[model samples]
Every structure is written in structure tokens, then in C-alpha cells.
Target: MENKQKKIVLTGGGSAGHVTPNLALVPELLQHGIDVHYIGTDDGIEKTLVHDIPFHAISAGKMRRYASVKNITDIFKIFKGTKESKRILKGLKPDLVFAKGGFVSVPVVWAASKLKIPVILHESDYTPGLANRLCIKKAQKICLSFDTADARSERSILTGSPIRKDILDGDRAAGLASLSFSGDKPVLLIMGGSLGAQAINDAVDAALDTLTQRYDIVHLRGKGKLNPGLEGSDSYRQYEYMEDGLPDVFAAADIALSRSGANAIFEFLALKLPALLVPLPLSASRGDQILNAGYFEKRGYAHVLEQENLNALALVQALDALWEQKDEMVSVMGNSKEADGTSNVLNVIFENIGVQ
Candidate 1:
């Protein structure tokens, strides 16, 4: 008799970063004939981001750093989410659970552990997030993006972050044409991330005149952050967010100014895009981006401009410095052994599932 088709469930959500790596793995998984499904909250960004697969929605309690009234109620929600996960997993009977850390992944990973199903967790930061930290003991293996001291355990594998194939297939001409750019000057891609960076947006507002003198700018100002005053500028274009043309934008960019999220920086490395990183301040985040930027900066893969020193003048000066070192940064990126981890992650998944 023929064996049943191998099945897998990917779990992650809360932000675009959490869902992106899982998306990168989908094409390859389908090509290999592995059945793929997704588990996330019913209303998360993940639900809208994921398509063409059996997506099972489950309750997920958000992870928080501070005590709040929601924390008390979320305990019950988490318990309910675990129950929902167990029911879904039993029905799917997946051979493995592959997860990129996010709040939604915690309940699912916990449920998978309880079911005696093997789980593989991918940590896309210099330091593990709380979700991954809680699931570490339950996970069979932990995949890492950085070769940090804390991730030196036997079960940890430094396979790097998986990058979407389309992100690496950007066409400069297409990007320029789509934006109505003349390509007379280098393109500057400024991304403040999905929710938008007010500081970045404000800095650009102050520096636009100076910046546009030498570079055409593409600004992904996050949702609801677009400035109508700057809409008429010929050398500048702004979008709330992009999907269809994002690869082209990346392709056309001469230098990237972005938040140093693990997913972002790794993709930049893969494309050999020179970057000027502005990590989220520690007061606003867990300091993961700071460490992530530090790692790349130390290796000459990118330059870091701290959020504390961020201003219109500082932004311009730092970008000028990044432009000066751009060629060297590209050379360093080309020589670096770190790369997209799609194949490595797939190999690990197959190895654990007792398949090729």
C-alpha cells in the first residue's frame, strides 16, 4: 500500500515579519509534495497574508511584557486556544509543526508538544522572543538566524532566515517604470515597517528637500502615515504599504533605510543591498533589533544609526556615510556565508519527518 502524503502545519502571526518566513517556505514545500496548512488567530494579519492553503484559526493570547487586566483574562483564552489547537491538529494529523515565533504560535506549539508531535521553532532574532523562549523546552529543534552565544546548544541550528523568492527577483527597470522614476539618480528605499515609524516619517519630512537633491526616494510610510503635502514631489513617492511591487522597489533601491528587524536585515543581505539601520528603541521594544543591527554592523554588512541620535540632519549624514561605504558593504555581503535558509529549513523539516 502507498503511504499517506506527509503533512505539516505552520504557525505564526502578530506581525508581517512573523508570517513572511513561513510564506517563503510554502512554494518549496509544495514543490516537494509536502502538504502545508497554517494555524493563526482568526483575525490576525496572518489570516489576510496567508492564502491558497487550509488555514485553521485558533484562539491565541497575546504575549505581553507588562501586567495588564487583559493578562488575567488571556490565561483562559490561552487554555481555550490549546484545546482548539489539539482538535485541529488531530484532524490534520500533520507529520510536523514548523513555527516562526509569534504570539499565536505559542498555543499551537504547546498543543503540538502535548500531542507528542515534533515541533521545529525558528528564532529570527539575535535573542529569542518570549514566544520562542516559552516553547523552547517543548520544541524538538530550534533554528536560528544568528550564530549567537546563547543559541549554541546541540539542538540549535544556525540556518539563517528564509527570504521570499520574489524578494530576490526584483527588476530595476520594472521598479523604476512602476514608480515613474527617471533612474537619473540612485533610489533610496525607506521603510518604517508595517505599523509605520512616526520618527522616520517626520525625519523624512524635514529632510526631503535635501534628500531629493541627490536621490529619488521610495517611502513605505506604514498604514495611515502618508503626508499629502509631499504627494506632489516629483522625486519622492510614498505608499502606506506595498506588496505587488515591493520586490521591484527593493531591486531599484541603491540604499535602504529601515528598522533592523531580523527578517528585514537578512533579506537585505541576500540582495546585497547596502543598509542604514535604525533599530527600534529599547523603550519601545525588547532590544532585539538593537542586537540584530549590532551584529550586522560589526561584520560590515550594514551601518547602524541609533534611534537616539535620529534627526533630519543625523539621518542625512548617516545616509551619506552609508553611501560612501556602500560598495564595500555589498562586497562583504557577497562574501558572507549566511544566506536564505529555505533549503536548510526544508532539509531539517524532512529529516525530522523521516523523509528526503
Candidate 2:
């Protein structure tokens, strides 16, 4: 008799930072004849992002950095989401659960553990998120993007972050066309991750006119509504989402104004694109971005700007400095190509699943 095909459940969402890597993992697992199921909340970008995939809907609620009256609502959501997760896991009976870090992952990880199903978590930050932190003790393995993550868990492995295969394999020409950029001028790619960063968007808005005059810009605005000024810039183009064709944007970019999310940071490294990072403020409960930014700043691979001190002029000045150092920055970033994270992570997962 043949054994049943093993099922692997991936729990994550709330932002592209968490879901993008898991999305990159899906095709690889599927090719091996393993079944993949996603567990995430409907409220986040996941609803639209994971549309065609087999996903179990559950509500994990929000994790806020500061105390909010809304925190009361989140408390109840955690309990409810946990119950939903247990029900879903019971039906799927997956051999393992991969919980990508976020508040939405909390319920699923909790449920998977309670059911005695082994769980693996991927932490994309140098500093772990609340959900991954909660699961660190319980997870059978923790795959991390940074070496520092090992401090958070005894079982953690520094696998870097999983990047999409296309991204890892993409070339300069592939990215340029995919991003709809002509090769005539320098391109500046702007992104604040999936949900967008109002602060970063605001700074971009402040500098748009000046920026567009010099460079053709690809602004991935995410879900944030556009600033009127950006909408009107002759040299600026906005995308609510990139839809799996990010390489062109990356390829077209001579410099990037970006948030320091682990996925983007690693992808930028893979592309060898110089970046000016504006770490999201602590108010967003993302100390991870700060650590990520610091790593590059310490290495001269990128520039860092804290949100509190940011303004249009300062942003312009920073861009000027990074642009002037383009060759040096690119050289520093070139070394980052050594990190092909997806393959490393997949190897670990395959090993865990006994698929050598």
C-alpha cells in the first residue's frame, strides 16, 4: 500500500512581508507532490493575495505596538481565531505547519501545537515579531533571515529569508521590462511593503517633483491611497501591487526608497540595488525594520532614515548622497548576492519533511 501524500499547512498574512515568502514556497512544495494549504485572515491582503490557493480562513486579529482601546477587540479575536485554526487543522491533518510570522499566525501556531502537530516558523526579521516570538518555544524549528534570530529561539536556524525563484533567477533585462521601464534613464523604485507606509509615501510626495525631473520612478504605493501630487508627477508612476512582476522594478531601479522589511531587503540584495531605507517607526511595532536597516548601514550597503527626522529636503539630500556613491553602493550590495535564501530554506524544510 502506498502512503498518503503528506500535507503541509502554511499559516501567515497581515502583510506581504509575511505572505510573499510563503507564496514563493508554494510552487516548490507543489512540484514535490506535497499538498499545501494556507491559513490566514480575510481582513488582510491575504484575502486577495491567496485567492486561488487552498486557504483556511481564520481571524487572528491585530498586534499593536501601543495600547489601544482596540486591543480589547484583538483579545477576543485571538481566542476565536484559535478555535478556527484547530477546526481547520483537524480537517487537514497536515504533517507540518509553517507559520510565517504575524499576528495572524498566532492562532494557527497555537492550534497546531495543541494538536501535537509539529510547527515550523520562518522569522524574516533580525528581531522577531510577536507571533513568532510566541511560537519560538513551541516551534520544532525556526527559520530566520538573520543570525541574531537564533538568540530568540534555541531551535532557530539562520536560513535567511526565502525569496521567490523568479527573483533569485532574474536578470537586469528581465526586471526592466517586467517593471515597464525604458532603459533610457535611472529608475527609482519606491515601496513601503504591502500595506504601504504613510510616512514614506508622504516623504516621496514631498520630493516627487524634484525626484521625477531626474529619474523615472516606479512607486509601488501598496494599499495606501495616492497623494495627489504623486498622481500628477510626469515622471512618477504608481502601482497598487506588482502582481509577481517585481524584478523589472528592481532591475530598473538605480536606487530604491524602501521600507526595510526582510523580504524586500533580501530581494534588494539579490538585485544588488542600492536602497535608502526609512525604517518604519516603533509605533508600528516593527523594531525589526530598524535592526534590518542598521545591519546595512553598518555595512554601507544602504542608508537609513528614521521617520521622526524625515522631510522632503532631507530625503532629497539622502538620495543625492546615495546616488553619488552609486558605484560604491552597488559594489557593497553586490556582495549580498551570496544570499540565495529560498534554496537554503527549502532544503531545511525538505529535510524536516524527510524528503531527501
Candidate 3:
């Protein structure tokens, strides 16, 4: 709308599970000559992921689903976060605010709404979180990761989730080198969401000797401590994160063991990698994982194992079942629908922002 590059603000964090997807949109917006600013809390994962980006820090206090005395303190924190967000908006005067909903995004979205700035939100979960639900009315558009989440909002459109462009374009040879493994054996990729699944990690820890016997393993340790329990064993590698290069890891893998987060789930499908899913328990407040895992299970694209029922034995058994039916699994993976979500999403944002 002006000669200067349009300033845009993005807010979301509190966990890598949310932040990583938000980060994926940065380069795209930058390529379009837009200046991006972030608003997030100091207390959450935003600090680690968006640390390099220009950001306004806010005190978005903790919000617990269950009743707690701490709620009183957090309410005050949320209000403080809103004030900080208002100041940032007033100073930046962004053309739009793109929010990936979480505790951190609440303030920025609220401020943008009050200031009458166009706001767009993305929900990576099938069941939207409370912060996102609150922003629904004020949000000019809602980008969703799955079809199931559509019922919650009239403005919702399925955009999958933004992932690194290279990941969406990976080749097999690049995939093999990415994990530092030879192309001889079938590669297996394991990820326990963003923070790492300690329970899944423990189960993998217990079955390492058994698993490496058949598959080359690339275990993403998430935020969990890395002990290198499988170092002495051949064909096993572990890391606390995968920011450096991950398309290679996914491209090399014949199968993957992953927690059911929207980013991971859709990326796996985009890569057409068969998977065994472990949904974070219902008590986790985001019942979306269950819905996500179930949707794939219904389509035979992946398998789901609830946390309570997951153990080393069960995990191995599921692995074996998948291996035994490799042909069927591959066929299912091959049939997966192609997802060209980012371009579609950008169109929606452009139309609303009055971009030519």
C-alpha cells in the first residue's frame, strides 16, 4: 500500500511444536519484500526459535486448562502482554498480523483487533486451542492444517502447514546424505514431537538393540536430554533437534515413528513416508492429536498408538506388523493427496491484504 516494504507481525510460540511452523512462513514473506516482526513471550520456546528475528517481547502468562490459583496471576500476565502488544502495533503499524495461536499470540491478536488491523490466524490442530478460539471472531481469515478443524470456523480454509521449501522438494540421494547414512538399508526416522517424547524415547531406548538390527535409525531427541544410548550400536544416531537440515532425513526414511503433531503429520504425508503415530494423551488438553492420528488411521496412511498403551514391546510389534505389510503401506503412502498448501494460503492472505 506504500512505497516502503509492508511490515507484517507474526505471533505464536510457547512450544517448538507451534513455533517451527510459524518460522516456515518467514522466508516466503521475505521473498515478497515484506519486513516481518514477531511478538512472543520470554517464558516460552519463542525465545529459542524466533530469537534471531526482530521481535517484541510480551508477558503472555501461563494458561492451564484445569482450574488453578495460578490462573489469577496468568490473567494479569495476559493483560500485560496485551499492553506490550498494543505498543508494538502502534510503533510498527504493520500491514497485517499473522498469528499462529497460543498463549503468546493472544496479546498481539487482541491488540491488532482493537487497532482494526487485518489479522489472520493459523491453527495446526484439529481442535483449536482456547487462545485461537478467542481470536476466531476478530480474525479476518483462518488457515487450518486439516479438514476436520473446518467446522469450528466459517472462514477456515485447509492450508496444511508451512514447512521449509527444500523439505517439500527433497530428493532421495540428498535424503541419505542428510542423515550421514549409506543408502543400503531402509532408513527409519523417529521424532517425538518438538520437545521430544520422553516416553517414546524411553521405548525406543529400550528397543534400540532390536530395532537397529533391521533398520538404520535417525532419532530426533526433541528437547529431551541426549544420552547416546545407542552409540555403540551401528546405524543409530540421535539429536536434540533438526534445525540444520531435515528434508534429507525425511527423504531417506522408508518409514517414520513420530508423534502426531500437525506439522510432522502433514510433512510425512507430503513426503509420502509411511508412519507409526503416537498421539499425545487426551489429558494434554489438545485433543487434536487424537483426531489427527485417527484421521490417518482411518485412511490406512498411518497407525496410532495411544500413550497409555505404548511400550517397547507394543512399539516393536507395531513396527513388525508394518514391516510385514510393507507393500500395502507403500501403496497407501503413494496414494496420499499432494499438498500445495503454501501457495493457496498466500493467495488468501494477498487477497485480504490488498496485495496486487
Determine which window of 10 residues in candidate 1 has minimal summed lDDT: 335-344
TM-score of 2: 0.85
* lDDT, candidate 2, 192-217, per-residue tens: 88788888888888787888777888
Each candidate structure's TM-score, on Cα atoms with residue i matched to residue i, is 0.96, 0.85, 0.88
Pairs of colliding residues, candidate 1? none
Which model scores highest in TM-score? 1
269-296 per-residue lDDT for model 3 (tens digits): 7777788999888787457888888987
lDDT to native, each model: 0.91, 0.81, 0.80
Lowest summed lDDT window (length 10), candidate 3: 335-344
CA RMSD of each candidate after superposition: 1.4, 3.2, 2.8
Best by lDDT: 1
| Backbone clashes in model 3, listed as residue pairs | 175-248
Residue 254 in candidate 2, Cα distance off native in Å? 1.8
Segments in model 1 whose C-alpha atoms lie over 4 Å from true places? none
lDDT of 3 at 256: 89
Kindly state the number of residue pairs that clash in model 3.
Answer: 1
